[model samples]
Target: METKNNKVFLETIHRKLGFCSTTYVDPVGLSGGLALWWKIEVDIDIETSSKNIVHTIISDKSNSSVWAASFIYGSPNREGRDQVWDDLMGIGRTEILPWLCIGNFNEILSSEDKMGGNNPNPARFTSFHGMLSVCGLFDLGFKGPKFTWRNNRRDGDLIMERIDMAFANAKWRELHNQAMVFVDAAIGSDHNPLILNTSFPMQKVGKPFRFESFWTTKESCKSIIEEAWAVEYEGTKMVKVCKKLRGCKEKLKKKLELGFNPDYLVTEKIIKGKLEDLWQKDAMFWHQRSRIKWLQMGDKNSRFFHLSTIQRRQRNQIVKLKDDSDLWKTEANDIAVVYFVGNLVTWRTLAIIGIIPCMVQVVGVFFIPELVKIGKEKDLEATLQRLRGKDADVSQEAAEIRDYFEIVQQLPKARFLDMFQRKYAHSLTVALMVKSSFYKFVTFEVPKTLSFLNCHEHNLNQNKDLTAILVFSGIQLYVATAVGCRVRVTDSHANTLLPLDIKGSAGSLITFCNWASAWVVSYGYIFILDWNPAGTFFILAGICASTVVFVAKLVPETKGRTLEEIQASLTLFT
Candidate 1:
């Protein structure tokens, strides 16, 4: 439109785009021009025009609201910019309705809005900033590039500035709060086009599920699949296989949760202490999220992981670039996991590498059998390599594992009758009591007290009595933590249910015990709410004593005996 000598040539271009009406500010002999076009039935009336501005009044046609839009084309000359500023201010004074003033203003509001440009005159910024402040207009932040105008220059003397801008009054901004301006690609001109958007579609958070093929490494997978598929079912062969797959999924999930027992982790050795135990759970979660289902996983998982990330980056329009300086670095790409098999410890490391003396701060390190030394010189030369030397403790344990398992394999089979005997029964009873009470204290009182403080703040006594509430909460926390710490199972006490075992029986037992405790506490809360606190305590005390007596009469002992002997004795005695 800049070089089109007259409206005749411009009309041809305008007609091609299907514009019905156009309000034109003809170019000053190809030096400058402005064009504002509207689709048919737009309900916009052109109120005013100038060499650098096009003002219009717009109604929604729905009898909803009316607004004013002033399209600005600011002058590029250093001195002529002041004229543009005066024109905007004059128009701003007359805007009574919600106003949106936008277009290529040929100015920027801040220094950061320019790249590779001569330092902006501070007075120019003050002029624009002062205008906005005085008129109560806000710069509507854009969605695309920070700088709307690019130099597009390969020469050493290249520059870019955010000359184009959009500002709205408070009412206009509030009406379209998520409004955005996007920069379109340059077509036949140096300046890229600007697209204003009033509504954006919402994005979904999480993705769909897809199984991973990496879970086959765990031995539990084989047994779980076998057990699931072995069952007889009346169905089509495909349907039968799918039913078996569903069953296998459930079994594997339960197996994966084996080591996530919160109390067991805090009390007994955690999975992190045994990677063989932790590996299955990690595989389960990663497999569920990775969404790759190939038979032979190999390096395909990693490859697909990076490829999807790259595609996503493109979709999101994320720019990964540098401005000819290694001092400024981006350390977001690449991943390398170095594992030390001999010991149970984790170290997270992120080291950036690039040409021409780049630098990134590496965080955390682990001994890879031996030490992993990372050295960097003044010129940013560095080496990160794994070296090897086995620890004596690790070697000793590795040697003893076979002997330890062999002894365990020799032990006699365990049964339920073994749990019910004349001795050691009180220990199991106490375990249940302490576990129940700990959950009750933390789950019931802590939340209840906090709720009371928040929901009934005005009803409470203030100032002179505030210290009493604080002290009470503090004491409650201290006692709970103290008792909770003590409630962790002693190794001797854990052996009580050894015959019942961890895999086949413990999950159901623990779930039952927890649910039973919850029900008991729920029942107590009812009486405590309507009756005396004394009545509730008395009922709880009776339950505890009744439990002790029940254990004494029905349960058994396994103290100071090997598991095989204990199982044998209990089996014969019962």
Candidate 2:
């Protein structure tokens, strides 16, 4: 895609792409270029051209629908990027057709559009937001990878940004309301390909079973349920209940297929009338548009009213939800999907896949040798020698392992009150402060942040955004926990009394905090914060801030200090 001359590859690409007509804005020194290829069925007329954009009016010969599409290669520099927005604003004013603007804008609207590296300049956000506002363009949210552009660095300095995007105005959304933007995997380039589908295809799925209120109106329905429940089943109470409900559903389905008896025809008429009245009311609710007022007074407008009701119902319904792979799953059969071996698989497949690691571990464990500390000194040396290698020296390592094990055995057992002693007070305080704050943030605040993400699902990308948030947050949690583990190990190694017991007590604190956090997050949201996402975050921030201050004031540097020294320091201070 990066080239200065159209002759270099445009003709070949056009032919291979099966596009009848092709046009391009030549690159300015191999850095910026734009190419547009269209099939014969699409009638495209070039309306304007610039170094960064190629504006065209595209008409579908099949439907005779016309729209404007601007292919952009936004300037990478800040000053020129500002000019690109200005040009787009001018085009939005002049162009009357439903407009679509898609390409690499080389800028992002907000911090969420990027990941890693230093935060972007706020002025860039201002320019982008201003352009979108002025042009009345709404971002057509995408699926697939959250970030489209990567720095491609193998080092830790890598950065990713969602610069490539699709945007359409209100008019364009009306014309193709089902339009979707898909970010395809990047091949041989750092930038991912953006696929703008004007109409995303969806599969038709049967509606889920729901018990009708009308069914409850009949005495026969009550008899059918009772009869189904009366069938004896051999299982646990929960299983019996499930079987009964399923039986009831099947019986109701069969009864539904049989036409109403002659005796209930009057009841059917009344139910039908009530349903019609509800539909009529729904129609009245939606018929508030000025042009539909003339037909509002009589049954003459029933057809229009019914169609309006159907449209409103369809618009409000959630027929499908997008899966992790960007596929739409209409059926509710799977309550959850899990990623197995780098691919998203169904719950059934995940159950099967979940056993592989366990089986491998079970088989692999038989081939492994026992611990060196479990035997006498002679046996320990022999075991260590075999584990290391037949030829490797094991005398020094065996002696060290024996001495460490002996020391561990000689240590006194830790008691519940021993942790409260004056010498151990500082250690306990540090553990409580760190563990409480860390676990609270991890178990409680993180879910609250996820709740914030749930609120924005409609406006932003849904499942994929959630996945990205989880991925980064999980990585952060894992790395921080790893560091804490290293510190805890060091602290235990330096302790004189009941090192294992102290470690266990610290672990117990972690477990208790973790258990308490779920209740705190659940009831805390209801009673304390009233489910306010921002308020929950503000409270978490205050907790974290206070913890930071507490750590700075009370926590001592235990680095390179032995247990006796640490105890002496605490005793001197007290």
Candidate 3:
């Protein structure tokens, strides 16, 4: 036996295997099982076994089940069928046990099994009954006279055959008193199907009640009775007419459980209408509660206080409905309770009483120290000005230093210098020149000489005592001057006086090895020489050599310059 869906297929397989003797087990919304039916043959050995029993088991990809005896069997050949009968006889002989072989044997047992009476083939029936006798098996009584198999054709007189059968051992015959097959109506099939119903006297068992079934059922049977009923009461003072009728609730619940069976229960129309009414009522109640909660939780002003009270009353009503247990309770009750307790009224009251402010204070502890630090730093400008005193200019230099310190505090120390240079290029430039005047002088003069060697003269000066240095690189001549000392290089062609001045007492003019092209100076000395086309270094070397020669050739000592004589000499030089 098989079915279209695998679940049904497995179920039918189980039933045919004798695991299920009655209606097959199934969940809701599933139809009956068997699709195609066939019979098979099997053998058992009662002689060699402890108990020679034929096991019928149905197995699909998902699940399997076994039965004590099956009605479905298979054989490889005619010899296999004979061999199976021999094995059953062997079991009966050895173990003194009875055997049963049953199933859908694909071949017809007899030509008489076919419907519309073609002719009965006596030989086949004789052979099959002989095999059963040899195995000590007897046929269980069936209610049908015609065979179970027919050619699946509608127009012609259909060919039928008795393919499915059940045979049991002598022991089963004694144990089971009544077993008969019932041929059901032709349900879109030429084969009039057969079912063997055996009375096993098994008790029925009920499964656990699922809450979903009850809930869905209650929703369907809500309106069988009238909406209002007048009840008369005998009271001491006055007769009161009670109108809230909860009558017929139990009846409605039972009807819901029966489901929408049109034949036995309420009409589908009434069930559907009641279900709709229940659904709408439940949805509207929840929706109203939700809106109320939203308003109470979201509102900041007291304008909705009265509305909030009305919402609270409505919420209480909903809660009462939910708590009744009969009205179909849900898990949303806990959530509704939380919303009611945490309403806007309560939250606002807490805020007004400074409870929220206290919480804010607790939260503020972590950030307050850092904020204070920032405030102090922001006020540092005024503090720095006061620290610098009234006459202080609050120099751009000092401000920049403070800015640098601030940056260094914020950034890494390695990046502090780079950031300072980028922000204050001019200040950094002046500072660099002051720190390395000698390096700057050399750099400036060498580039100037290469660019304007014949066009201009160059002059440079350095003061060791004042730490001042200056250079003048120009056309015609190059001159470098220092504290209380000066060197002058005159244009050789002009033969003009190259002014050389030494200040203070013990100062004197010294000239040595003057050349036609260039000149150099050292101490209170001067040297003029020809330009070396080879390189500037050679020219500088020659100048230094000439300066050495001047110091040796002409030496005059002076302590410092006299102001009057220095001014007079400057006037004479001009």
Candidate 4:
């Protein structure tokens, strides 16, 4: 079953795994090795091989369709990884088939790609991004733990990253739109194995049989039930009742042949027509209830109609009402329904609370000066000087804002899609990275629900300490914002495309990411924490810590810099 020889070892594994063929590229100095085992039904043609990668053409025996795949084990050395990128670029140019590249590339596309460690070299990220762009490939997002590889360290020096991944081109995505990748648990190895399912798994569903109310209308139904009830059964009272009901259901089903109906169309039409009539009658009745009879009589302006309204009002008016238990009562009790029951506050009180705050804003708007961007030239200069301190010179900054608005007025209005243009790709990438990281960090820190708070309270063994968690989170967020402001301060339009629409779109993205992070973390807390709380918390803490490194390594500093200077710095990355 086992052998020291490489071929014999691989053959034994292939045989046990029910694979008909096996091949391997031997390891060099315990670093580089490659192996593949496949079933006899699959047809794979080896196109090229190297120490770093093996390229092959895979043919689906069932469909007679072919696709190319590159199995990579990239070199750890910098120069060697760069060579692998070059080789991929070359293959991307010549190969016309839909291609997929999957394995450990020994490189990361961004700081977000790794957890626990110093930020990776920016050059490596640039190279990886360039390679993917040249090849028109994108990550096929996975469903499992965020990271696929982790160091087997139990101490503070532990690290984990998604070094192993899968990428496919648009053609491959189109051909296999339903395909998905799953990360299996890593049993003895550091990296988890991936399972690529080309189609969704089949689910076996058992439908329970129920007795229908309509089945009673059949003439034979009563006889079927009577016969079932008359049969003798051996069980307790509850079990006997269940058996009788089940027997009656089965007899009725067999007698009626419920699976098929010859008169389905005729019966359906009659029922639908009756239902439509009922709906119309119900709608009309409600519509009549909403009408005001007094207003309708007044609108007619007729003596007879007006007299009838007055007579009805006089008859309905109460002179004295009898209380419950037939006692006479003079004082009227307020029995109106409370429409706004939130916190037991009525609608009138809620309206007053809302309107009272708006009075201050309505009055304060007149005293506030006009904005520099849209106000008259004189007002713009005065507002700018007041904001910048009267002693300071504000002519240039004022002119810049005014001139920018002037140019904006002359240009055609931008659409939402303008934010996604090629020229704005760098800005979009930065925006998404910052927003997602910010939300993920915040979502993890805050308790998503009461259960989450209870979990923390249970762990801390003090209900009062819950306040400390929230207080520290608030202080941390404030300090982080202050630090971020110190590092980057620029005009809004300098780093954004379609600035008017960015707020709405960014808000939507933030909300979606927040919800997604909450959902993921909830599952992680439920499933992962039950098994290993330390491991779960460690992964979350690593993610939170990595966000700080991501911002430091990726975001450009704009402190005390002009708009032109900021753009010049960002030019290097784009």
Best by lDDT: 2
lDDT of each: 0.54, 0.65, 0.39, 0.60
Per-residue lDDT of 427-532 in model 2, one digit per residue for the tens? 6666554544244453444554644545445233335556567646854764465455445433333233224545545445543553444334443443344356
lDDT of 1 at 90: 83
Q: TM-score of model 3 relative to the true fold?
A: 0.24
Q: What's the TM for model 2?
A: 0.42
lDDT of 1 by residue, 207-273 (tens): 4333445456545567777988798777999988888888877776677667334565464354456
| TM-scores for the candidates | 0.36, 0.42, 0.24, 0.36
Per-residue lDDT of model 4, residues 268-380, tens digit only: 55786656544443333333333334444113233233333333332333323332222233333411222124338633444445444334333222222225334677876
The lowest-lDDT stretch of 10 consecutive residues in candidate 1 is 355-364
Candidate closer to the true structure by TM-score (higher is better), 2 or 3 = 2
Runs off by more than 4 Å, candidate 4:
1-5, 201-574
Error of 2 at 516 (Å): 51
> Which parts of model 1 have CA positions greater than 4 angstroms off?
1-5, 204-574
Which pairs of residues clash in candidate 2, taking residues 3 or more apart in a chain or in different chains? none
Q: After superposition, how far is residue 183 of candidate 3 from its true place, in Å?
A: 2.7
**For each candidate, C-alpha RMSD in Å?**
33.2, 21.7, 40.8, 32.6
What is the Cα-based lDDT of residue 464 in candidate 1? 24
Angstrom error at residue 144, model 1: 1.5
Ranking by TM-score: 2, 1, 4, 3
